[model samples]
Target: MTVPLLAITAWSGTGKTTLLQQVIPELNALGVRCGLIKHTHHEMEVDTPGKDSYLLRKAGADQVIVASDRRWALMCETPQQPLSLAELAARMDSSVLDLVLVEGFKGEPVPKIVLWRRGVKGGVEDLLDEHVIAVASDEPLQTGLPALDMRQPAQVAAFIARWRAAYR
Candidate 1:
């Protein structure tokens, strides 16, 4: 079965990541195995220079995966090509996950929770698509979509749970 996917999107400083950091634990407590896919416009390095994994990648390994007792990480070289959300999701091990929480991809054609913080560079107005099913905002948003209090993680998690339940 295809795992359910939800994109949490907003402008910089809108607390999208912060909100997810709170909501994910609550969802885990409710027995939901959630996977995350975050998109970054800037270059990111998970491993430091001179590290074994870093050296492996530097040596031209297309995909370098390092696993330990505690955690495992994979560094795949995409070489400037932007992977679509669907393409990224396909790369994940979704068989054991109940939900996939995407941290960006605002333009993607997936259901999303748009985080709207006042005075931010972008607002809910930027998300004019019907795929945006909910809006989590510090202030009121002028839209018909369900407005969720940005400060309430439990409520947000509940909303996600309810939505997932309905789809199931």
Candidate 2:
């Protein structure tokens, strides 16, 4: 079965990563097995330059996977194509994960929780579409969506757990 996916979207500097850092652990404590896929506009290289995996990948390997006893990562070179949120989520082991929390791809069709801060310059309303399920903010606003406290990650995690339960 396809694991449920949710996006936490916000403009740069809106603390999307910070919120997830707290929420993921809370979700884990709630017995929710979580997977995450983050999207970044900058060029990314996960392997070290002098490492064997890096050298092999740079020398023409399209896909390189480095595995250890406890962890593994697959670094695929997709220079011309960018995978959508669904495509990236498909690469995860759905049987082990209850849901996948996304850190970007606000334009994707997946359900999203839009985050905003009081002093942030961007307009949060621009991100509130039918795909947005809720709004997490430092200060409460007039958006009719369910309001979540950005300062309290446990509350956000609880919301996610409830959503995941209903999604299945």
Scored by lDDT, the top model is 2
Clash list (residue pairs), candidate 2: none
Put down candidate 1 lDDT per residue, 30-147, tens digits, no spaces. 8888999998888788889999889989999989989999988888898888677888898889778999999988888999999988888965687658898899998777698899
* TM-score, per-candidate, Cα-based: 0.94, 0.97
Cand. 2 TM to true fold: 0.97
Model 1 CA lDDT for position 18: 95
Whole-model lDDT, candidate 2? 0.93
Q: Which parts of model 1 are misplaced by more than 4 Å? A: none
User: Model 2 segments beyond 4 Å from truth?
Assistant: none
